[model samples]
Target: MLIWERPEPSARASLSPLSRDRIVRAAIKLADADGLQAVSLRKVAAVLDAGPMRLYRYVDTKEELLDLMVDAVYGEIPAPPPEGDDWRAEVRSLVRGIRGAALRHEWFADLLGGRPHLGPAALGHLDATLTALRSAPGIGDDPDALMRALQAVNGYVLGAVRHEIVELRAERASGLTEHQWQAAAGPYLARAFAAGRYPALAHVVGNGSHQDPAEMFDAGLDVLLTGIAAGA
Candidate 1:
């Protein structure tokens, strides 16, 4: 049974009043403030003003707590429209919501895909994605095709968001804007380009306009959706 499904034991009424939701929220708060490494049963209990052993009544282990935390954040993502929403647009919205969540909880990207998320909130998000895919105008009832398209979009979002979070963390750590960092590295890149080992990269890097991260993400999503349409 999922952690949320298990009933809280009645014997723990004498201890600090705690539920799985409270513990999960406390953990998320700790993670958001200090990253995933800062989160632990002891730390969360302290945050709740309870003993470490009191938390075991709600969650058995730290890993289970992490799972709950991930799902709780997933619950924050907006659900797709019930009617008249284009599949491609829904996919875009879904991914953007995930990106926003990752930005809000910097530690979220680390735990994503770390384990199966059977929690109700995570399963609801998955169901919403599948519902949109199935409702696509051209996508018939081929489960295999639907699964492939879902996987492709999911794979792209995970990779893109992971890179974004890494760069964001680096920027935070270095206290340098992306443009400043690029400018600092410009001379080294110029030297490498002058060596002429990669003409195509040199040409693009030298001449191409810098695209904002959102634009890049949208462009990739457009390409992915186009490919899915063609295949459909």
Candidate 2:
């Protein structure tokens, strides 16, 4: 059975005082500091001053622990402020919330949308998003449209966040800012552009200014919301 389906153990007097909550929190801390690769049952147990075998009482397998960690990150996402009937505003806020959470816990982008998140925190975030989208006046009483709308927004967010995280990871690993990285390969790019085979790429590369990431994400989201509004 999934961890969420299992009843939480009641608090009992004990010297260890260890619980699933503590285990998950410790794992999250490790992940936040050193990425998901740093997390393991043995390491989590070490952090909690317990043996790895003891962890099995709370989590049946490594996958369950990962699920708990993912859910913990979801719990960090704040609810959208009261934006009554303004589906766009509400959704925009929730989208930003998810992005913010991903940025804070880079490992989150690695796990999210990769599997079904059945934990309470994950379910709560999904429920909140659906509620916000359901407020769309034009989408009223149409279950199919509402489901599509939710999936579309979630799909975009998942893809975009993964892309952002990948770029971030690359930048960190290479020890170079994007502009610096581009300049390092300027000679190669110049030769390629001069070939006249990729006119559109060259034109855009020459004409486009460096855009702020946040602004770019917001602009893309706006385009999506506009299309949704028109269709609904």
Candidate 3:
């Protein structure tokens, strides 16, 4: 059974006021202000103005706490569109909502899929996606096809968001904007291109338009959605 489904102890119900919700919230607050690494039972307890032992009443391990934190963030994702007639549009909307949530929680990309997330919010998000895919004109009741469509969109979002997060962290570490960093590295790239080793890389790097991250993400999403439609 999922952690949330486990029965709570009745003996200590009146003795302790802590609940899973409060523990999860405290952990999320710590993660938001600091980072995932800053979150611990001790720290969370301190945030709640309680002792570390008090937290043990709600959560047993740090991994469980992290799972709860992940679910809490998933709870922020917007629900799938109600119409659901346009599968592509619904998938696009859902994927973008997840991306936005990841952007807001910088640490989210690192901990995603760290464990099986069977929480109510996580299940709700998955069910919504399945409903949208099933509603697609050609998909119908084919489980395999529905899974493939879901994975295609979900995988793209995860990979894209992870790449974005890495680039963002790199920029922050270097203390330079993306353009500034590219300009600084231009001479090295020019030298490499001049060596005539990577013709394809040289062509794209030299001729490609400097599109913003969002535009590039949208373009890629469109390509994936088109492929799914064709397969459907």
Relative to the true structure, how large is the alpha-carbon lDDT of every model? 0.86, 0.86, 0.82
Off by over 4 Å in 3: 7-17, 114-116
lDDT of 3: 0.82
Give model 1's TM-score versus the native structure: 0.92
What lDDT score is found at residue 230 in candidate 1?
82
- Candidate 1: pairs in clash: none
Judge candidate 2 against the unseen true structure and give its global Cα lDDT, from 0 to 1: 0.86
Residue 188 in model 3: shift from native, Å? 1.6
Question: 79-130 in candidate 3: lDDT tens per residue?
Answer: 8666636877777777787788888988888886534478788888888788
Compose the digit string of candidate 1's lDDT tens values, residues 174-217: 99999999999989889999998689989999788779999999
- Best-to-worst order by lDDT is 2, 1, 3
Model 1: number of backbone collisions: 0
> Model 2, 41: alpha-carbon shift in Å?
1.7
Q: Please report the TM-score between candidate 2 and the true structure.
A: 0.92
